[model samples]
Target: MTLEEYKKEFTEDDAVGWLEIDKEFDRLYPDQEPKHYAPPISYMLGGEYPLDGVSIYESKKQTDHFHFVTYGFSELYYNEEKVNGEFSKWGFELTFRLKPFEGDNGNPPSWAVALLQNIAKYVFSSGNWFEEFHFMPANGPIRLETDTDITALVFVNDPEIPKKQTPHGEVTFLQITGITSAEYESIKDNPGTAEELVNKLRENNPLLITDLNRK
Candidate 1:
């Protein structure tokens, strides 16, 4: 989903927040002019973002919450000068607080799950601005972790070859983490049912489950 669509679908108060980066770097060997290389990096607001915002004391004082980090990488190319190259990388880190809506009910709200999943999909999806990407979970399992309320997810993107050398190259690897114990058990108990759950979760929150199952 586009940034505008994301904003529209999830409100700032919906226990979800994210951070994004779009950057360009220049490489130079000697006295020659610097070539421009733009690499985009996007991230969702994770435990780090909130802590940086309200001070460590405030964030540490909080009891219940969730955190996630994701990264993406796109193809790169040298500018006309050939002195440098351009590579696109986008990523996001996110954090969510359950206190806002926890007391409302016993079971977690669909919106909460949807929001988290949506953001996850955006970070891991190949369709995004990245040619390839990887996700890493800070806490537990990568795919489905439902046993715990608070969890952390992370993603990273690294290209095998330099952008100038292989502008159209593909991503070699991707990693994701932060699965809950309950989620693990669910999958373990019901072998082939993981796909069904993934589909259901994606249907509810398209933002988080972008093409994860695709080879």
Candidate 2:
């Protein structure tokens, strides 16, 4: 659905601030866990020759960003030992540029809250089929804007797979423009008859989340 349509249906509460969608897939079918990778290290032996050591390491990364700021999460796996396994979490360097909005005089718009809730619902329902799903606002500055368009960065889990990714199972970045509470109320009262109005909003302020990446 269009952003304005989505906003009208869901943005009933003002307390809603941010929304995110996250998904999980079976990295391995038949209940097998994905293999972990290791980093190779070289060490000096007997102060003469160099020796190589193989060190086991986790093989995944997670990140999130809003408006030139970023936040990250962790991935953990349990081994047969039930105690020994792999754990990796990066709460580090990543960023995105924030678009300035006329209404955001330092205050976010009310629509942001509803948008975030809808995102959470979509992710939870779609990703629940996998083993687990994790969702959280990547700590940073995410705001609504009127001047620029934003899109989600789409990426593939396996680049070798050749164009398997559709507009699904990826991050969704939203852009807000020329929208106000009065306009929203008009659409709500009109229901399905407001296609022209919806199109106007879509034409004037496009909302898209494209270019999803796996990094």
Candidate 3:
């Protein structure tokens, strides 16, 4: 899309990027009924979260991973940068493929939702960004309810969703996967170990499953 065309008509009419992303998703799962979750009206009015919503789709790809895609990480409005050509403010929306927690039934975990929101908040507030293979320490259990020692997470570009070009800029899809305690320590001791972990993950599981039992 040309800068003039995008700024004048496209972005002006539709401020939501979610619909476009949804179309990309639908192409993968035709007519799938993804359980969509939008924050309450109050949250939109004035709340801690800035995202418009999150959509959770049960994946039949393998191992019953719950695919969580978030909205509001990219330019969701007719902002001035639509013409500036600097990728989306953060250039990526977070995607998570998680194995179902045993007691959670088929319901998506709210903590996963909260984690996405907090990451969005960090980007919007601190101007920090996440990219493929970028890792972060949770300082505690990622899933607070579980005793699993997967305390830190490593980011990888989502395999299913390719980077898309939007009027605002290019939006990349990043997936977060939990890493084992030993991997975290390796990263802590040698920052370069993170790249090794990413390589190992790609070798072992191209999908990057969060295997708590992984040593």
TM-score of 1: 0.25
Give lDDT: candidate 1, residue 158.
17
lDDT value, candidate 3, whole model: 0.78
At residue 96, candidate 1 shows an lDDT of 29
lDDT of 1 by residue, 1-215 (tens): 34454456555453222111111111211232321211122234232111112100011112332222222232222222211123222322232223223333543333444444455455455444322222223344223343343243322221111222222222222223233445445655774665554445445433232222222
Between candidates 1 and 2, name the one with more favorable TM-score: 1
Instruction: Name the best candidate (by TM-score).
Output: 3
Task: Tell me the lDDT of candidate 1.
Answer: 0.30
lDDT of 3 at 52: 81
RMSD of each: 17.2, 20.4, 2.3
Ordered by lDDT, highest first, the candidates read 3, 1, 2
TM-score of each: 0.25, 0.24, 0.88
Candidate No. with top lDDT:
3
Of candidate 1, the 10-residue stretch with the lowest lDDT total is 49-58
Write model 2 residue lDDT over 131-196, tens digit each, in one string: 111112322222333332222211112211111211111222212222234444454566443445
